[model samples]
Target: MRILVILRQVYEQKSIQWSYEDRKLIYQRNSYNKSDLHALQWTREYKLKADALVDVLILKKEEEASEENKLANFGIQRCFRIPSNGSEKEDAAFISDLLKNESYSLILSGYETEDEHSCALLPLLSYELGIGVLTAVYQLEGKPNGQLTALRKEERGSLQEFTIQLPAAVSVTSHISKLRYHRGRSAPDFTMIEVKRQLSKPEAVRRIEAPEPNIWYADTPSEEIPQLRLLNIMGFASQSNNSNNLQKQTDHLSKAHLYFTAERLVKWLKE
Candidate 1:
């Protein structure tokens, strides 16, 4: 079986700064998405257990030496790099076209990217490739008959089990087991292939100004006596708190009768 894991480069949240004047964010450092790392770890374990071939496709702004070295240390033999166009739709289309000739039993990717927080690419790719996609998968196991059992994490801390056939794609969540380091492992001579495709220019982005802060202030207390002020606010004079007025209001309420007749009550109930 052949498994392909899609990895994306993302900016570290701690290394990002807000440019208030430009109304945009500035990125200082790049790192692998945490969920993608989990997916890679899962793929590695699956490959070891099932003796399947695993490959990684990296979507990055540019090919970096550090990233290549990292992949070599992970012992992946073949690595594919594609320039990211910063548009999910374009990237999905390009990848779908590039993967048309490849025969992979399963494809794995993170459920969502850290920078965009969008799950658009995988679904779009699945649609173009005409394959089923399972999302938010945290645990996966392969069966003897080319079937996979996946445990998906749902909202409110719930798990849903699914049985999927081969030739499917899965998006993994970050809650899976962390990656284990292999010490003293010999670095593999990995093959780095750069895939190039012409992509349309990304649309211009509009900047928006920050909203003004809202503050509430309390009303100043009146100089009058507290009891008198309370009475005035309640639409009652201090002198109108006598028992006679209260009795008159109570009598008015008691004298009020229901206007609905038996026929009307029966009609309302029927309706």
Candidate 2:
């Protein structure tokens, strides 16, 4: 069996900051998405158990030398890099087109991107390829009959097990498996294939920039506003606040309380 694992580099969320003046997000550093790492772990396990040939496809805005060294630490022998257009739909279409000529029996990817928190790529690619896609997959087992069994997470902390045929795609969650690092591994030298097909340019449209909202500060203590209190607990408040007490209070709040607080905040914002 042959498998292809799709990986994407994303900016570290903790290192990102909102540029209020620029009205955009400023990125600091790039890191491998944790869920993609789990998908890679699953690929490694499948290769070991089924003796399958595995290759990785990396989608990024630009190729970097550090990617080769990082993959080497995971003992990946073969990898391919493709330039991403940064649009989820365009990337999906590009990958679907690229996979059409390939002989890969299975495709794997992370459930969602950490930076965008979007889970639309795999499904869109599968739709374009006319193949089935399984989302939130956590466990996979190969069968002797050439089919695969997969366990997926469902609502209310439930797991559903089912079988799927080859030539399908699956988006795995971070809870699937832990990535095992191979230290001191030599990097594999592979030829980089450049994709020549260009996405057709859409007609340019005029864009309008909206005025930035004024920054607001509250005179009331954070404890009086549930939303501000939640933000304080999440380390989004002013640094001068008592973080130790906030952490203690955060630890004491139940999950239900957090959920309700977030829901209320969303409603308040909409209002």
Residue 27's lDDT in candidate 2: 70
Error of 2 at 26 (Å): 3.2
Per-residue lDDT tens digits for candidate 1, residues 1-271, read: 8888889888776788778787777765788777887888887777677777778888887544345555545546578888887788888888888899998888889998886687877878888899999988878889998999999977566789999988988899987657776566455567878788665677758554554578866454463799767765666655555643443222243323233345558888777
- For 49-150, candidate 2 gives per-residue lDDT tens digits of 777877788887554434656676443556777876557788888888788788888888999988779798888988998888899897888999999899
RMSD of each: 11.3, 10.0
The TM-score of predicted model 2 comes to: 0.69
What ranges in model 1 sit over 4 Å off? Answer: 21-23, 63-66, 181-188, 204-271
Could you tell me which residue pairs clash in candidate 2?
none
Span of 10 residues, lowest total lDDT, candidate 1: 248-257
Clashes of 2: 0
**Candidate 1 backbone collisions, by pair:** none
